[model samples]
Each structure stands twice: as C-alpha cells, then as structure tokens.
Target: MTQEDPEIQILLDQAEELYSSLLRGETTLADATCSEILIKLETAIEKKKHELKQTSKTSQLC
Candidate 1:
C-alpha cells in the first residue's frame, strides 16, 4: 500500500477518534464537529489521491 500523506493521516486519525466517540455515545448532538471533520477528511483524502494519481501519470509520460 502507498504510504499515506502526513496531513491525511492526521485527519484520518482525528476523524476515526471522533467517530468512535460518537458510536460509544460519548458525543451529543451539540458536538457536531465530527461531521465537519469527516467532510474535511474525505476532501483531503480525495485531493491527495488525485494529486498522487496525476504525479504518477506525469512520471509515466516522462
């Protein structure tokens, strides 16, 4: 597997923690931050994957 970008890793870790907390009933509706974090994490992962894919294509063309 490809190594994860540091920023992506951090976001993933944070999102995971938040999700787990929600699952355990530790977070309330007042704590709506997890949804935001999940959205950010999804966007970041997609951006990183797209960047890597483009880089790979460029390398292949060279």
Candidate 2:
C-alpha cells in the first residue's frame, strides 16, 4: 500500500484530535461546527497534495 504524505497525515491527526475534543465538550472554538472543521481540513489536504504533485513534476523536469 502507498504511504500517506507526512504533512497530510499530521493534518488528519490534528483534525481527529479536535473532533474528539469537540465530542468531549472540551473545545474552545464553540462557534465552529464539526462539518466546518472537516471541510477546512479537507481543503488543506487537497492543497498540500496539489503542492506535492507540482514539486514532484518540477523536480522531474530538472
């Protein structure tokens, strides 16, 4: 199986922790809904993946 990118993995881990905190009623960002957090995380992961792909292509061209 392919390994996950470290940066993306970190983001996922952080998101999970935040979600867990929300479930436990310990989160300070009360205004942010779980779905909103998830959407932001997903967007960040996609951006990171795109950056990695661009970097790889640039390196290959060198």
Which candidate wins on lDDT? 1
User: Which digits, one per residue and each the tens of the lDDT, describe model 2 over residues 1-62?
Assistant: 01456655666677788878877888766544545556767887778778889999999999
- Give the clashing residue pairs of candidate 2, or none: none
Candidate 2 residue 47 C-alpha distance from true site, Å: 0.5
TM-scores, all candidates, are: 0.70, 0.53
What candidate 1 gets wrong by more than 4 Å, as runs, is 1-4, 28-34
- Per-residue lDDT, model 2, residue 30, is 55
Q: Each prediction's Cα lDDT score?
A: 0.77, 0.70
| Clashes (N, CA, C under 3 Å) per candidate | 0, 0
Query: What's the TM for model 1?
Result: 0.70
Candidate 2: regions farther than 4 A off: 1-14, 21-34
Residue-wise C-alpha lDDT for candidate 1, range 1-62, written one tens digit per residue: 12557777777788778878878998875584647787887888788779989999999999
- Which candidate number has the best TM-score? 1
